[model samples]
Target: EADIYQTPRYLVIGTGKKITLECSQTMGHDKMYWYQQDPGMELHLIHYSYGVNSTEKGDLSSESTVSRIRTEHFPLTLESARPSHTSQYLCASTGLAQETQYFGPGTRLLVL
Candidate 1:
């Protein structure tokens, strides 16, 4: 099975609150990615990292930030979340850019 996980599954919070969406993987893959997706819709890449100490922002410049210190952990944090930040955050990993990615269930954030 794919060794990835996301917590809360669902979140409902008022606007202008701090939130952190947890993402973890046990597969030890070096390439991790974060994507924002609307409910029952397509996904938009928001963050990605090549490996430890190497992180980069995705096509979407998000209010959220991510970190990669260990091989199997990458968590995203939003300093102050807003209603516009409401979306599902999906975590994925691949052995290589050309390889197939393993995705987690995702965290659904609903900023009120």
Candidate 2:
């Protein structure tokens, strides 16, 4: 079981709709990340934050944006949804004392 949580475990939206994926951790982790993936494909890191007020875009280019204003919450938002944006979003957080990361149940999105 993981302490991290993700809202709207599954999402279906039309093109041009705005959507936000919420992620939160109960473990008080300072490091959090968002990954984009397709079924049967490798995960791509899309965004990350070291702590509050610190965020960086990841290796993959993503139209979505993320914010880390509080220590336990990190949310990803897309201003306008598109069919090309369909993918699974995974949220993870790592404890300061451990290298292991706790992952939330991924949000599966489909934009039609």
Candidate 3:
């Protein structure tokens, strides 16, 4: 697994707060993805990118946004967070072997 890390592993904030969950990978993988998961629930893909400047929404529709400005950085942002946005955001990256994914410690967001 690639060395991936997520910032602010746990967060609690009032509603309507602007939030940015940072994800950085040291393996320099080209394929990165963001997923959302509620407690004890299945994960849902929210965004992905094949490489820098190549971003696309994932299978699940999301109110948040993501950017791939650099190969090592992929951050998800909510312009205005809400209670409904409370969930764990996972960051994953796949190397040449696309089937294998290395995941970071997820950022658990709890918007009041």
Candidate 4:
């Protein structure tokens, strides 16, 4: 099983605030993904990266930036948060040759 974790599992912030949702994995996986979802909604891929120093935008139109500085770390940052940005952010990682993704406990953000 992939050992992944997210910090600040629950957060409440005001709009226009800057926030970063951190995601880390113990497994040395090269592929990481970030997803966003609303209450009772499907997940939307926001960002993903295959390896260090590689970042890719997913299907969703997001205002978040992600960095892949290390194989086990992929953090998502929102420069200016909004009410619409309030949702659950999920982190997932998979091995280079593996298709099965192991997910971390999501961070739930509530922007006031």
Reference-based TM-score of each model:
0.94, 0.97, 0.96, 0.97
**Candidate 3 per-residue lDDT over residues 1-112, each given as its tens digit:** 4599999899999998999999999997999999999999999999999999999999999999999999999999999999999999999999867688999999999999
lDDT of 2 at 46: 97
lDDT of 2 by residue, 23-111 (tens): 99999999999999999999999999999999999999999999999999999999999999999999999977779888999999999
- In the range 59-85, model 4's lDDT, one tens digit per residue, is 999999999898889999999999999
The per-residue C-alpha lDDT of model 2 at residue 62 equals: 97
Best by lDDT: 2
RMSD (CA, Å), each prediction? 1.3, 0.7, 1.0, 0.8
Between prediction 2 and prediction 3, which has the larger TM-score? 2
- Whole-model lDDT per candidate: 0.90, 0.96, 0.94, 0.94
Flag regions of model 4 displaced more than 4 Å.
none
lDDT of 4: 0.94
